[model samples]
Target chain A: MANADRIAGSDVFRPNLTGRHATGRFWQTAFLGATTVGILGLILLMLNIVNNAFGLVAYADGEDYLKYSPIPVEQLATSDLVVLLTNELSTGAINKLNAEQPLDTRSRSDLLALVFERILDREVVASSTLAEAVFNRQAFEADALAKNPDARFVFKSWVTTDFLTVPMSSQALFAGVRTAILGSLMLIGLTIAIALPIGTGAAIYLQEYADKSLINRIIETNIYNLAGVPSIVYGMLGLAVFVRVLEPLTSGAMFGATDTNGRTILSAALTMALLVLPVIIVNAQEALKAVPDSLRQAAYGVGATRWQTIWHHVLPQAIPGVLTGSILAVSRAIGETAPLIVIGASTFITADPSGPFSGFTALPIQIYNWTVQPQAEFRNLAGAAILVLLVLLLTLNASAIILRNRLSARRAN
Target chain B: MTQALSSLPVTDPQDRHVDWAARLRRKPRPVETVVQGLLFLCGAISILTTLGILLVLGNESLAFFTDPEVNVFEFFTGTHWQPQTGDFGVWPLVNATLMTSAIAMVVAMPLGIFAAIYLSEYAAPRAKAILKPTLEILAGIPTVVFGFFALTFITPLLRSIFGEDTVQIYNNASAGLVMGLMIVPLIASMSEDALSAVPRTLREGAYGLGATKLETTVQVVLPAALSGLVAAFIIGVSRAVGETMIVAIAAGATSQLTFNPFEAAETITGHIARISGGDLSYGSLDYTSLFALALTLFVITLGLNLVSRWLVNRFREQYD
Candidate 1:
């Protein structure tokens, strides 16, 4: 111990003077800071969404003003307030008695059940007029009378159930996005039908058949460029080509000859297909490229034709990737609003699209319309629509993830 | 020439009889040539599509320019974009698009590059596996949802902090910020691949010379991967430029293009959306202007893509 200390203390002994330690600490801190900020931002975004959604629910329930009750106007006007109170009590009791009357056995029970549900759902004890002023008829009546012991009954799941069953209308309570949902599904189906073949075929040609010539290079470049082209550009192209030039084909017999507008589900679908074609091609090409050259050579050596090799070996290996890409493309297509709007997708279609050639609206367009409206109820509906859209996108993405995991497992084996 | 001929020995035969038969086989067969020709033709389709778009756009734009309805100087320099009126200037729309895209790039580039650096250089295999997929989820979220998010959540938050008057209902900040968030995953994924492609030996050499992890990354790995990083940036910017729904829903439709982030402004895409909504006659200047704008957008994006491709090919290291 003494000899080591003497050596350390000696003049020839020089301490490690490299800046590596300081620089390492600096960078580690920087990296940690960045990661923290990125992850924190994502968490904040999710929390913000949840918070806003919860706020909407709270506003609908009117729980904040539940404790305050307004004095009746008759009480304020009359010196004999007791008489006014009695009159108010009599009116309420009589209305309750009338509501409970069972002219039809089935009707009486259903009314009783509905009244019970409303009483359970009420948050505030305000005068009927005040409640009417604050909450919508359904929310106010459901909540107000439910809390009043003197009142008839409670409200049930009418709002929740009606949310799904109804179709869009000017009235908030009657409005639903069923038509929009149906239109979205049809558009997605048609988009996939149009894009998958063209995209996969182009990818196959690029990866397998075409030699690495200048022309192939240009095609590859063009596809990448097309992928980045503003989706609105495709919308313009569709309007010009599909709507103006091929209006007859787009507008079918159902729309009538006078209805020459080509802003149908088919036109929107074709435009979206073009918008997402580049993404599909890029993904399909990557998948095709991942298939080992040795596999193709082996298949050919075994007397398999090029078509047979692609059909049997290449496609099976590439299926998961192709499906993943297709899902992503469809998800983007479903979320697209600008192109569809440019291609004249309707904002207020009350009826669901029965065929490809019918005029239609999609969820995004529906949400946009709802958001623009002045009413608070429509905003809530828009939130609900957004929730539905998120759920669909999440499902698609989750399936893609599952597919990718399966592919990874297979590759590992 | 002899060596090259010798490499293909099956073309020659030992005996004269076999040689004659081999010569017959050596001639290019019609079937093989025909198939190759067919493959080339299929490959030409993409080029044809590109040229077709250019030709269509050119013809339409030429018609638009000749029309008296289109004021050429006003279209280029005017700030107002009231198409409902006859006034047509593109400066405001162009300015908004460029400004928003610029803001998006500013936000996305540094964050994306840092994330890429950490993933490629610092992260363990498990961490990389988990973080990569999680980050990609950001990309998968539909842009419409993001738009709603920007409007409903982000806009209100900005209003609360900056005061109600400080932020417009449709300002560039929220759209550009959310767009930046959306593109980060894409840039990170590609940039990480580029950084990972840099040889480990370079890093080891730097470390052996007593350089720190930061020094090695900034000085050695970054310079080496400069081309790929640039490509990633260009692609990310292109994505930001092409984004439509985000700007449409969150950014306002007023084409009074100003650099102020708080102002409601329109983009070329927003103009397309707005004009297409109205009933315009076919072959009108208003209708053809859409094609002209699309053509310009196409040319810019195509130029960016070509540059990226060139950079990748010329500077990217190929490991055999």
Candidate 2:
């Protein structure tokens, strides 16, 4: 200690601490800039979506049917709404609607929507982005008025309850994501059903059953490679195997639908299942590996067979972990686009997919389709659809994450 | 369960232990045998998927290359890629893919590394708790959403900044920039793991010498995790190359060999999506060309992944 104290004297070489501390603080702030960039990217992405989703829309013609009605639009009864629609709509249009479904039988909201749909042919002539509407509304309105003197400018959110339930129309204002959302749900449900069991089985085989053989090694290594393969390649595989080689099965020819080809929900679902298989297997294997050796030893010590040990002890404990993996797989499958596009998602599908044999279009596919259209309103439609898709993914993921946290908390206990 | 157990045919209690041991030693029950076979089949399915991809791509690509209309030498060496005009140079598509990936790396590399350093070296526990899941959600967002941002948000902003003549409505810059954002979480998370895995003793040694936190982190820790960081970088580049939707949506359909980010050009993935999305006949030359492009993509990404895995394994051995 005396030698160190002597070395610390003014005669010895000195180190600069204050400057070094300043440098450290600067670097720390600089590192925080990284998080700031991430934050800005996220905020910008949301802002872009919001900018397109809600804006001032210039309608070329009547959306003022509310002024004609004596009651406030929201307070109008179903019969009153029907009467308003009857007064404004052509008898032919009313008859066609009645034939589709009686107006009296429709919900009040539905009747009100019909009033807008039938009485007021509200064709949006011009639109300004959310930013322009918010920041430069006077200028935007003046410009819009120059183009269409009679145009009624109303701030509108393109995404609404009516927009979600109705099928897409030729009119951008009337187009909805009903078919796309349904196709996505059906595809995801079927993909999980096919993938979860197969993936879990594969993981079990690799983790528990397979011995150290060359074939097992090959299979194990093959999965790692398959997981890295571009999803478009998987789509090519699906295009060949499911849509071509197995056309009779996927096209429902065996089920007496010989008129159609193999581009159906079944083929798409099978493709998605294959695409996510590796991810599910890898995750499930990680989950299985977390099960301690003692659990298996205890089961075997009691005269249980290998399968009995797996079923009674290991699998029960592994279920939560396995479920977490399935949720990841679900998310991947939901977000995947290129493969579905490659396997040929129908661009114009509107009919509700009735069976596996039905043609399909997912939410992503719908978004892609809408975004490519040359019209500004179509671009707005795409934005609204993107919001719907994000909401769907958010709900599913939120629930799954919550469930995972709960399971982990319980385990910690 | 007791009733089922009691229903089993039983011998005397004295003989039961031997019988039980014998049963345990016996070949698995039929149900067990069937289940094992099913599992083995499931395991092999991934292998079949790989083989299936190889077969389909190879077969159609073979047909395309062998056709009298195509010269294999020209396909590789040509400079132009108008499929209808009989010029089949793949370099344009390949070039666009590389250019966009290069642009993506430019945006992602520094931000990702810095984020990793912050998360591993400087973040408080409370900060991490929020930041981690937020990053995960960002990672989990669909690339199609990113595509929308590129088209509606980025393209306009670029146009406004650079002048309308300077930026194409559908340009590589927007797609690349948004894709960079999409990949930030991947690189950050992976590199953060590499940073975290650096042994603490080394940092402490540097600190013991009165070195600053930043100096210790930059000099002592980063060099140690260099291999893992490289692996993460390679993986990120591979992901950017394979990314399809953003390019398809924002990057224009023109297949040109140019380094300019403001100009639009089709990437290999984008070209494939564009051609396939059109109403080309089932057995057309264009249809087959997609498979060949897909084969190229697969090979590139596969090679990248193999290298990354190798590096990651080597990195793990150092610490483990």
Candidate 3:
């Protein structure tokens, strides 16, 4: 104790306190700056998405509505709009529209859409982003209209209800991510169906059944390593195996519906299942490990078999965690673009992915497709798709967290 | 009724199995056996996935290297990477990858490490909760979105700041910058774990010796957690190297060897994504080259992963 004060007084390890505090303050500022950068990055990302999702565009091919009907275009009833559309469209075109969806039963908006698409044939030839439209409207309208005097300049919200309902089109004005959204849902649904039970089973084995054997250890390590593998390599594997080797099954040739090749939703879903398997297994193992030993002992003491104990007790206790992991896995699968691109998702598919065997594109793929295009309007469209994808991701993660919290709360009780 | 009577009353501890010989000789439960077999099959899927990746890459890479136009030595050492003119050198792709990854590390390391230190050592619990989730949101963003962000926002920002003459529309610097943002969450989360693992005793020891809080963190705790921090940094590097969509979208599609971050170039992943998206005939050299690139990526990430795992285990054992 006497030596401690002497040591503190010694000049050897002592530094000037004021300089030390100054250095600490400087480092603290630098660290706070670092944290600020991350938050700023996130803010900019959201702003970019919103700043492009709605915009003003200079579009060509508008005709006077008075020429086709007595009423104005916006005020026209469904029958009036249909009349205007039928009078303007050719017989073959009418038949095609009818075949696509019944024209007689179509709503006013549908008929108006038909009139605009088929009769007026509006296309976004040029555009300004939401920021440009909002902050500098006069300049945007002046420049846009001057560039294309024949074109109509109007405000366009890229995430309108029609944008959610319409199918893909070559023209950016008419393009929507409906098919892509449907495909993503189908892929995530099928992927969860395949991955959940298997991932949970694997976790059960690793946590409860497998002993400290060499093979089990190897399997455990492999799962961890696989979790870290780049997702693109999984796409390559899918292309080589699911698309080529298992084409007969993936393309539905074995099921006698061989309209397409192996680049179907089934193949992509299968690839994603493999991609997320390790993540699910790891999370599920943590969940299973959290199950109390007392529950297992009680089950065994009651003359229950090991399978019965796992199935009835351990599994029921771990269900919330398993579901949480599966949801996270699904979120990862939905945002994945490279693998879908490699496994041959059609960027131009118009038809909704009707089943696992159907050709598909996803929301992320749609974003990528549009972002790569040279047109500025396509970039706006990509922003809208990104917003949708982000919303989906947030929803999935939110649900997972809520599920975990509720289950853990009940456990605490 | 007899079954009910016999199934009753096994609760007495004194009624424990007396006949050990008979119990040891009892028949195995068939239902339990089948259930375990099913579970084992489930566990085997991960093994099958690894095997599948290896087999697919190996089989196609075999076809690629054996082709007459391709030279093994040239493939590794050559500067050019055009497949049309029979040039299969991977260095251009490698260089672009390195340039972007180097830039990414430059941006990510200091920011990520500093943020980790702050979150672990300086942040209060409330600040930690809000900041950590916000960082995760940064992490949870899809890379394709970052790609779009890079192209639409970061690229234009750079072009305006530096002037269009100096910066290309699809420069490596923009992609690398956004890619660094994408990787910050990984480094921060992992390194926070490492820093958190440094025992409290060490910090107290530093404080006892007239060390300030910052001094304790930097001199004592940092050294104690160096192994895990290095592992986290290595993984960050690996992620930056393997990142695809950002480079594919923001970095240029053409391959050339250049260390200049302002210049446009294609990475290995960017090249593979570009070519494979196009219409390539099956079994062509171009298609085979994709597998080769994938194999290279796989091997690199796998090696980094193994080393990081080893380091992490060592660090954990030190504290556990």
What lDDT tens digits, residue by residue, belong to model 1 across residues A289-397? 8888898899877656576788889988887888878987987888888788888888877776888888998888888777666454555567667767777778767
Clashing pairs in 2: none
Candidate 1 chain A weakest lDDT stretch, 10 residues: A56-65
Candidate DockQ values, in order, are 0.35, 0.68, 0.69
lDDT of 3 by residue, B1-320 (tens): 24633765645588675764465337477888898999999999999999999999999999999999899999999999999899999999989988898888888888888899989999899999999889888887889999999999999999999999999988999999999999988999998998998888888889987788899999998888888889988899889888889999999998999888899999999998999888878899999999998999999999999999998886663654
Question: Runs in model 2 with CA error above 4 Å?
Answer: A2-15, A62-100, A107-121, A402-413, B1-23, B315-317
Ranking by DockQ: 3, 2, 1
Q: Whole-model lDDT, candidate 3?
A: 0.88
Q: Residue-wise lDDT of candidate 3 within A185-254, one digit each (tens)?
A: 8999899999988998999999999999999999999998998888889999999999999999999999
**TM-scores for chain A, candidates in order?**
0.68, 0.87, 0.92
* Candidates in order: C-alpha RMSD to true structure: 10.2, 3.6, 2.8
Stretches of candidate 3 above 4 Å error? A1-15, A62-72, A403-413, B1-18, B21-25, B315-317
- Distance from true location, Cα of B160 in model 2, Å: 1.7
Error of 1 at B131 (Å): 1.8
> Which candidate should be chosen as best, given lDDT against the real structure?
3
